[model samples]
Target: MSDIYLFYKPFHVLSQFTDERTDEESPRTTLAEYLKVPNIYPAGRLDYDSEGLLLLTDDGELQARITHPEYKLPKTYWVQVEGDITDEALTQLSTGVELKDGRTRPAKARRMDPPKVAERSTPVKPRKGKGTSWLELTIMEGRNRQVRRMTAHVGFPTLRLIRYAIGSWTLEGLKPGRWRQTTVHMPEQTQKVTLKPRKKGRGEHAGSKTTHKAHPKTAQPKSAHRTPRKPKGGR
Candidate 1:
């Protein structure tokens, strides 16, 4: 059995527990500052500049299930972007955007009203001569800064990114820098099934045999483009 937690990560807080960049004399705000739980780790990362709900767990299997791309769990983000986004841009975002890595899957994108949340310590720098708009974008895949890249591809660079929900979990009542213990109901264990190769012709070499091995679900390593979720900044 494993314990789960939902944390509302605040701006400028590192998603991880340690700060390799600084020693004890110059310690920065990390997960250790807000969460006192031992042995729990973040499932997926939210960049240092972003903020919102982050899932933490002590179970490796549960973590893999949530972070692996095969599950296709949707992550919804509330993004504040530069410029008055046009319908065409929104459509492009919903359809798919061409990123440097590859084309993203079609997403659920729509204009949104300003969200009511805790204010950031520092305000977003006003665009030189551009207006801003809010958008609610939902993506099923967790790529490196996917939302920010997608918006930028559609000509609306993101100014603030907040992940509001991941799969069924949400930041409903959690406040910035606050956390709570929780549980995840996982499926019951089932026997593994492996398919063996069918019998070959009678004359065929009896010594030759084949078997199909099922690949176990696993979590991927961090990616090159994936930014570190460290204590450094805001929304």
Candidate 2:
């Protein structure tokens, strides 16, 4: 049986076991304080500055399956951007953007019309001639600071970011710093899962034994007796 948990992380909480005493204050809330289960680690991490749904699991294979890029799990975010957002900007975001590092993958984005979402506690800076707007975006890739960079590249510049969902899991009724154990059960026919072994070649053969044989009275090979050759003259 596998153990999986869904946690709603709040802003300013570090995604680590130990809190560092940096300029940013140490996290007052931690997974240990919330979750009583043992041996579970976060499937993926949410930045200390970001907030949303996070997954934890005691099964190492399940962790890799969720966090690894190959899974391409879709993550949804509600972002508030600075400046007036146009349909063109939304279209551009949906298509792709050329960031400083490289082009971002195609994403789904749409400008949210009123009734707009409630304002954030700390509102973004207001522009002189332009106004801020909200957007709903979904993307498959979770690159470092990806949503922020993508929005900035398209001239929106995300002011506030909140992840809403990861794959099938969501924050739902979970408030900040709260977590719940997920009870997932599958029938016998539905549980045919396989994991590749870590070793390779002959080493992977079942019941194969490897024994190291000691060489008796063995001399050095002929190549070891050759004299060192001089390098060709350089100009």
Question: Considering every candidate listed, which one attains the maximal TM-score?
Answer: 1
Pairs that collide in candidate 1 are 12-233, 14-230, 14-231
- lDDT tens readout by residue for model 1, 95-147: 99888999999999999998998988667775799878999999998777889
Worst 10 residues of 1 by lDDT: 205-214
Task: Give the residue spans of candidate 1 off by over 4 A.
Answer: 23-27, 187-235
User: Which pairs of residues have clashing backbones in candidate 2?
Assistant: none
Model 1 global lDDT (CA atoms, 0 to 1): 0.72
**TM per candidate:** 0.78, 0.70
Query: What local distance difference test score does each model get?
Result: 0.72, 0.63
lDDT of 1 at 58: 73
Tens-digit per-residue lDDT, 1-235, candidate 2 = 3445667666666565555444465334455565666566777777766777777766555566667677677889888888878898888889988887788788999877532333444556767776778888999887778998888888888777778887756666566666666533322343222222122211222112222111121111222232222111100
For candidate 1, give the lDDT of residue 45: 87
